[model samples]
Target: MNFKKIIVSAVAIAAFAGFTGAASAAIREVNEWGASAQFLYWSAQAPNYLQNIGCYNGGWTKTGPTSKYQVSVGTCANGDTFIFRVGEKSSFDGPLSVMGSTTDPNRGSIDPQEGCGDANPRQRLMTDETTCSGASCTARKCVDITVGASDVEGESFTQVSHGMKYGPSTATNNVWIDRAFSAIDTSSLANTRKLVVPFGEFVNNTVTKNGVTIDNLTRHQVVQIYSGQAWYWQDFGGDYTSLPITRCFRHAGSGTHATLDKTVMHSPWGGALLTDESLVDPLTWFNDSSSDLMKCINTIDGAIGYADADQIQKVGAGQTYPNVSAVKYNGVMPTRATIANGEYDNHWAVQNCYYRPTDAEAAAVCNAVKNVPSSKAGFWATTCEMTYMKDKDWTYPVYVGATCEAGPSCSDGLDNDFDGSADAADTDCQ
Candidate 1:
């Protein structure tokens, strides 16, 4: 059947009053059995209340024999016009009665007399019928259901607009952190006198230390030395070891690199030495290559490198080669506790930051991140942390469950877990 548009309009008066007229007056049939329902009306006076009851509402409670089905009414009204259509389904075998009303019945018409010429337009109300019979009797039950006008076009327009406004974008960068240290032996490095590597000045010689801790001094010193500013280890208060200090760093384009650059090379030092100019190409500094930072640390006796805390633990576990030693920065060891409490402060150089693809995508990703399992998201993922560092009032960096306060001396470099040698050398406690 061709689609028809239904419009209902009404006139308004200055005086506000309840409808004072016959409750039911206009009755019009717009269709027949096994057909659709359509109706329209326009009036000088509008109805105070309009009710459109479907066959499901106990169609036609007339005093007559129960039939298989019945017809119902459809309404379309604005301020003045009130139009209605009543129809019966093929399953319906009973008499149908249609009713309509307006606040001023005398002024409104349900089925316009001028619109539906001489023959009243029969409204075909849709109905679904199913037959059921018990030992006592057989009967057919009629269910009144109508297919109304389509508002899909309008709804589609709204949906498209909303999607365009909040759709995901392709501009954001994504980085993955590997858990290399989980397999390593971190406890063995406890209390060992291994060389410490500092990321920046924030990790100075004055910081506290625990066995196997990547102290603040070590982290800061590494940046200084790598950038060619601190030519010797003694420049930073460490023992003036004659051996050339080895430097380890995260690969280029890594979030770890970003954190290191921001906290150590950039912010604390005002980007004086390790500026973008010196480290012109991040890929040259760090990347997925084994011959890269990780390989350099593993092969070189005095080399150091920065990776995810998980990766550090993995190296200790013997899952991969014992790559590098955990350096002490400013004397304070980089234990999980120091990171959590902001005491060691060196760990603060790193962050697991997340951004939404778009404003709408943000809501969805944020929700998914919250629901994702920690095991699946990896060690450094922000599942445990609630505050986003970029957000307002966010005071602390997110902490993984790494801690050195379990009675392990931070300076010994011995694997307190009893798996192997000092610091980065331990295959279990990285």
Candidate 2:
């Protein structure tokens, strides 16, 4: 049989087998909250098919829909079987027990918010309704709590959460966050500092520096830069001896910086450097500019810096300096696979968060903030004060590599495809 036919037949066989199980008295009720509320109902007749039948709080719209109520069919199924494509807070409601047969998948109904359903105090403001004038703002419509920088440690990363708590504040215009990497030439500086490069560039640089196989390094080293222990090149079994370590970090208020801190330093140093004042808190070992962080790593001996992989590539290609080296963590080198998998745990986290201001003005201001076009743009806008660092990189570990076949993907970075592969090559490798 042809590939298409074979695939279809396999699907049919699986479907048939799935339905052959004894009729279940359970009905799966999946509810999604944030930006919109979506519910899916499943019974035996539709054991494999979930019908999108109800909605509330927000409805579908042309420009962008928001309402106190809405419902759509065929949007989700089996409760936790879909990802929130839009960046919004959400939760699954139920897997209530019901009598269901393959001929009739509908069994029973349950409240969408019955269990620990998803709910965010923050709601995103409609784009057209917000405006920012100076630091103050106003929102045209009602909204959640206004999101402000909290004095609490780690609050700099809580913009969306706070915005939802105090939104609809005001309509205000602010800077847009952009994602781009800056170049640094260590040769130009009198003192060379160690820079921490992202996992990808670190791996390539490590290969170039030691002539070792990149794959030999454990995935952990590629993503995270451990403090102190992995400081010297010799630590990784490399030949370089007198490498002066220079710490590289994103701009003071960049989300990338926040993510790195959260992943690498949140445990031992939880509130130490992650306060509202120092948004992008590096390890406190080295100081370098976000633009030249990578270049510093490339040109300086014993240099280390952290940067987005894409930005590192750009700097390595365009700059006049020599390429930098990345250190390996636990023997695994950083690569697309390691990053996709949690094996290379680093500072980055899943980028998903939302907020709405209760104050009309704040809501309006929150709405005006748009997603950054690139890492470079995000970095620049945060530096320019057009946007706050909090909203730029709000991420959760949910939906890391989840697929429709299983429950919603959680942030642990597993292969939900059940294809025997864990992350990179899995069918659910998004």
Model 1 RMSD in Å is 29.5
TM-score for each of the candidates: 0.34, 0.34
Please give, for residues 1-430, the per-residue lDDT of candidate 2 as tens digits: 0000001123333433432342542222222222111111101111121211111113221111322222222322222221111112221000111111112121111122211212321222222222423332232222222222111112333211111111111225211222222211112111111111123334224333344423333434423343433544445555544343334443332344544545544544433232211112222222212333454455444445555543433544445434654445555444434443444545333222122222322222222222122222212111111111222222323323322222113334665445666655553233
Question: Which lDDT value does model 2 have at 140?
Answer: 24
Candidate 1 yields a Cα-based lDDT of 0.27
Global Cα RMSD, each model:
29.5, 19.2
Model 1 regions more than 4 Å off: 1-220, 234-240, 268-285, 288-292, 316-319, 331-337, 349-363, 371-430
Name the top lDDT candidate: 2
Cα deviation at 307, candidate 1, in Å, is 1.4
Show model 2 residue runs off by greater than 4 Å.
1-226, 229-231, 236-242, 250-253, 269-289, 315-322, 325-347, 352-430
* lDDT at 238, model 1: 53
